[model samples]
Target: MSGSPLSALSWRKSSLSGPRDVCCVEIAFTGAATAVRDSKNPDSDALFFDERVWNRFLLAAKTGEFGPN
Candidate 1:
């Protein structure tokens, strides 16, 4: 992720994001990995995750694995 030029990638904000939202993230899918970046800092470096790992994270999130206990 360090050597790649993320600026050239086409990024999209989540459907949950809104015009008035102050905290949001944007994502881009590469051939081998998914990249995520803070919407407030598009020019900054992004965090990259393997496709499988990203999918698992999404599933867990949907199932409330990250919810407060």
Candidate 2:
């Protein structure tokens, strides 16, 4: 969150993206925090979070803390 907004940041798509063009969240690891944005719109808005918070988020996602599909 320390850097400028998504309008100013450089965004890129993932190389491992799926054949169906699976919608993924683009990320910029700025060392102190992680910035995420919609893959479809590289120049759009993004959500930024502290590295610790981001790690916790990934853990919860992996553990299905958001409830079953």
Using lDDT as the measure, which candidate wins? 1
Q: List the residue pairs that clash in candidate 2.
A: none
The TM-score measured for candidate 2 stands at 0.66
Q: List CA RMSD, all candidates.
A: 3.4, 4.5
TM-score of each: 0.84, 0.66
Q: Could you give candidate 1's per-residue lDDT for residues 1-69 as a string of tens digits?
A: 434699888899988887865789999999899999998878888999998899999999989999963
lDDT, residue 40, candidate 1:
84
lDDT for residue 48 in candidate 1, whole number 0-100: 98
Q: Candidate 2 on 1-69: residue-level lDDT in tens?
A: 345465565665678787665677788777677899887666566788997899999999889999995
* lDDT agreement of model 2 with the native: 0.76
